[model samples]
Target: MLVLFLIATTSSVGFAQIYDLGGMYTYHYRDGRYSDWGDFSLHGSRIAIDELNESGVLGGARIRMTNENTIDYHCWPENAALMAETLMKKGILVLTGAGCSGPAVDIARVAEKYKIPVISNGSNASMLSSAEEFPYFVRVVSPSEQYEGYLINVAAHFGVEEIAYFYTTDAWGLGARDVIHEYTQQRDINIAQEYSYPRDTPYDEIKSYMNKVKQAGIRHIVNTSPTPDTVMIFRALHELEMNEPGYSFYAAEMISADEAPEVVAGSLGYFAPMVELVPSPKLSQFRDALEKRLGKPVDPSSKAFFYGALSYDHMLAVGYAIRDIQDAGESVTSQNMMTYLRRMDFDGTTGHVSLVRGTNDRANMPIQIVNSHGYKDNGTTVDFVSVGRVDPATGELILNEDSIVWPGNVTTPPKQ
Candidate 1:
């Protein structure tokens, strides 16, 4: 009887397992303490774990999270190898939540070298999935190239024939501006004007260009920049009273949810590809748990589940791969693990998992537009209209839902 009790106690203790997920958090500008932007990714990972635990998927699993400060200071290629080594030593199988594209690529190189997959929360850059560099990178978020195509489709719907392009000198702006220009050309769309300005340059320049656009009868404006800069552009527009029946602007995902609507008022619209986790029964319960733990409502735009969801899915993939190898009575080597991951299929909260052709290929991503008219600063319902799916054949959107404008799960009351 005593021997049986000992076996039961040992079995209970041995059932629990720990998994480590490598993560990197980048922020805007630079601040020593925790960044609100950084939390956006962390919250994503936390929400994933919370949901997995509740669902009994990770009932006895513990996750050790690590934050790589690539955003604080740009990490070099060598540093990436060092970081990967450290994570590998700790038995980490995945790297998630890289915000900066450059550093994210560095991490990707190291991960691929080590045969560990890096899942990104940052806006998709084709370089991360290119045949040359990317072989182990997977992006949950849709690529920026798709955003340009989406806006083009939406603009056509609104009777916008000509568009003026204004962007920053930053890498994101340059990449997006170039790709969009090419796409617009292919579609036979007329370009009223194209202007690029430095990040620290005056909003006066953007306004000056806007004046030209207005004079030239250009109605649609596409601004590809961060929230701070985007706000300046709109402030300039507001000052000029550029608000008109046909005047509109589309923006990238860099626009912060907190300030995007308030800055633009009801005059502008945003275009980008975002993951829709709202209205999810699993997500709602996770939100409640987060509130109970944090003692405050999770910010709607915090992207609290971004990294969390990616991490949970990453671990789930790893766990299933392990179970498969164990079942086959094969030793779990990196090569064997790759074989399992290559053909692995699992239904995750994020969606289905069927990798694209190459090593860096990820699942299909959807595009949506958020027109923040009735949204407030703290909380607002983001108007998420399904635009299209990312088409692997042409790397463009296969737009079927031409204009299915839908309400977000959370909405701020209209101003009185």
Candidate 2:
């Protein structure tokens, strides 16, 4: 049975006329591995709402997301569709949330059917790039396809002629797997073997899969799994003694620096739609405000922080669209909102946010390649450092080869 969890909204300014915005999120995963992402995202959205209303961005119109409207779908597709329809019935101008790909896809379908716009902070499945299929769907993050080229480049950088690929059997994982296959083929990089695992595969089964990869003598591996599953994969590799010199691991998702650091140390990975946050007074103020609201220090290097920043930008985009529509002496409707959203270009917390002209994905968002290495400032601490980046403007793959601490604490790429 599917259950909907409602999040209580923050205080809102009283207005005679209010614009309704709905949210569908995964506040609690079955194993509670991803709840922090949902919680932080909700806080970010609420903060944006409060600021937008207080700043009088919409003049007489204020945005309101009530507790009853924000539904937690638990990352289930069925629940997402159902919850989206429930909110649409209330005449929401735009639908927000959908922190994961499965729920994001479902919500997009529902929004398309109703001719309403849906903005996502976390969903990055490549299939969502189809404007024809999901005309009303847009995301603050780049699609999974954008990361594949960088992954292939990293493999080629290490002189890897072949790689073993592992991915989960889910929307995000499958989308990433397909794109990687296309990219590797284009680059003439051989895929030695492909392994697909269910999201809930047991530890022993993962270990067995690792053993098979070891038997195959594949030193270059690329994994496209969520962070939780990535942790288990690293554990299995550690147990098999395969996460050492001469064995390279690359991930499609970013893992927390504090999560099983001993196992994932020296692994290379990329997270999309992010650039180093430009230091500005506004950026600093936003960080301070967000940290105060979250009751914790915001680690710009952390994945959760990026998600939160994207969520904040998600609301800002919506607010800006509504403001533009009203400024044009037009009624704030779904169609008008969609119009302004597609042309959105602004400096957001996550950097400059803009949608591609035809596709639903963001444009000119850089992908950063990070190495899980010991922080040079504090040698005892393991953290992710920017070793390379895909230049957003030129699509150039830039690597600081001398700075990367490769697997087994080596300052050079391990030969395959």
Candidate 3:
């Protein structure tokens, strides 16, 4: 029952052959301290390759995943240029998962100059999609800037006034903080106080900042730190007694169920552009088959599934695009793949994905907030807040035609 379906079945068309595909390396910015987590981008990349191999999508096409060593995130742009150059020289077909915004944009520039196809797993800054700058880049994740509007509306909807910005000192956090700051100002709201800490910061160093957060007389907080820093913030809040009622916290892009729920447990809430709630029959079948293969339940938030799903969809897109060009007897080159990607569309785990020609040019794929301590398959455990569709222009969240407010939700804690 192994059938390889081509987009267009023609006599000239043939079952796609895996032509020595490899690579999918991640470049991290933090000093090598967090290397053990491996790159989150690599997780989605691995899942794509593994699923392809198992499903016989390419009829046993081989794909290799690797990593680029770097101690700093700023070095990612240069590191990405280096990795793309080395791999392109070796004839690697696709480059996916540039860990964050700077590196992702850099990789896209390099890929375009050399005509290599680059897809992003994490680089959500809107600028990457800007047509004037990046012509060869496409990311499965929605732009982080668009999500800010959702953040503001979500906060406003909950009657949050005073807000604090607790962000990591990195490209992703800085970029988002800048965008959210601009929008919030344009809307006539100022951040009560802004606090920052570097990655791998000691808890002692954050105490004063935590005190400032407590003293801001603010009722809400917006954090842009990664998983570890996020955990530390929550732990600090507990010790500082900042987790009590009358205060709430909002975060973007770090809601994987893999992390201990305690990080966000007592907080009011957190937000991300999207979470894959709509189970794709394709995704479910893939999940079931993967569980059977691994002989264990896969961590839904594990890098394995994220990168794997991204990579699988990436290749599937490539496969369809290639078939389209091949039907016209056109040569399958990086340049043509780039052209096809802009026009190709299909359903995958993340939802409907497409491309536009400018930085921050991508559409906001609806919003979902989690109120639970952790994600789950059971219906009763997870409480979802669909905060209406975000109108990117003017930075406003239009209440959904039918918004559902969960009963007995967590309330904000009063500031000391």
Candidate 4:
């Protein structure tokens, strides 16, 4: 599911003066903790704006941007909706973020009420794809279907017949769960059982769930739950010594092992997104520049393309949409921006992006497959590496290696 978006106009290359456009970054996670994707997306937007100003993409016009941090953790959009209302009251019609799924829904409600445009990297629930329901909404990220397909394709490829599923109850989780339901049926992979938790589920309950999981005699578990919940599950398994052997756990969260490196060795695999092993020079340049700018190492797991870039693409999409509107001699307003955005398509740091097909989805970005390579340097290092890629266009599962490295140094899919 998407968690971010914004809109703006484009300028002729010959334009030499800076003009004003309203832009703001809005985000709210379910809890107090921040989102890696959201933070990196903000970074991506700034870098894109920097490049736009430098290139005079606005025909002597530049964007003046601000940020809104909505404080809430229950997926309640009241705080974010209020934030959007204030921005609209202040005459800022175009906005780009609501990085969490739940808040995105309320932000869209505000956008529709204001009769303005809102491009978001927010909620990725497939239901949000309805233009009739959310005409003011747009997403710059790929659909949740792509990630679900990644897991399904790999599982089927390894001859896995029955798998277990663990998902959350929120929009992102529901969207992915729906995708998984459809795909598993298509692939003939039986879901042996399913489990779930809410945004505020307690740790003891998670431990109790693991007791049930162990009793179920399941081997392969497909996890698309929230990061914290997954961490708790994995830790419970580690303590229970369920990480012993013949247990396979895979998740889409790239940073799953960061906080609990000790629990994730051998058994965990994940979707390695947005970064190319053979980095392009342009991507390399952007990474270095951003790393230097951030005063630290830049991680690509939060990426939309290179270095987990999404807002970069969304920001560029805004510029292109705005330019298209201006080319038609139209003033840049919410309606005008939305209209042009429907026809605007561009290739940016996030690969191919388009919303003209009547959907706010990115097209043709692959989710790279990753397997835990096992840690080295005395179990301090978490070594999850690229093992394959699931192409979005072709739906092919291509593995880099002949065999996968499962937990406990087992180099094969755990048998049922």
Among all candidates shown, the one with the greatest lDDT: 2
Off by over 4 Å in 1: 1-17, 27-38, 50-62, 66-92, 100-102, 113-115, 168-175, 197-217, 226-229, 260-262, 277-280, 298-344, 377-416
Clashes of each: 9, 0, 25, 25
The residue-by-residue lDDT of candidate 4 on 1-416, one tens digit each, is 13222222223434534333344343334555555555565677777778877785666556656544222233444476777777777666467655556567677788889877777654556666767888887887666676666777777776778888888887777887898899899989899889887865787887777777778887777877655566666677667667655776667555432445645642444333323334556567667767876788754533322333656667777777766766777777777777776665776655566763767665566467766665644565456677787666687778875546775566655666
**Candidates' RMSD to native:** 6.4, 7.1, 6.8, 7.4
lDDT tens per residue, model 2, 253-309: 666545545455434232222344556675676778789997877666666666777
> Candidate 1 — worst ten consecutive residues by lDDT sum?
407-416
- Tell how far residue 26 is off in model 1, in angstroms: 3.6
lDDT for every model? 0.57, 0.77, 0.57, 0.64
> Residue 40 of model 3: what lDDT?
36
- TM-score, candidate 1, is 0.71
The order by descending lDDT is 2, 4, 3, 1
Q: What lDDT score is found at residue 219 in candidate 3?
A: 56
TM-score of each: 0.71, 0.89, 0.74, 0.84
lDDT, residue 1, model 3 = 19
| Candidate 1 C-alpha lDDT tens digits along 1-416 | 99999999999889766555666654444323334455645565665654555555444555546454222322122254566556655556566666555456666677777787666655455456573566666655445665656666655655566778877765556677777787677666777788888765676776787788778876667777644566677666666666544465666643444544445453343445555443555556555655666677665433344434544455456556656766787765655666676565776655665566664445564334545443543345333344445544455545444343221212221111
lDDT tens per residue, model 3, 1-416: 12334435542345445443334443333443342123433444455566555665443234444443212243344465766666676666666555456566666777777777776555677566575577777766667766655676566665566688888766666777887787677655668888876666887777678777777666577777665566677666656767555666666644334444444443324454444435678777666655665576765544345545554555556555655666766776777877776766777665565555443233444344433333445522223345455443345466542333221133332333
Candidate whose TM-score is highest: 2
- Shift of residue 301 alpha carbon in model 2, Å: 0.7
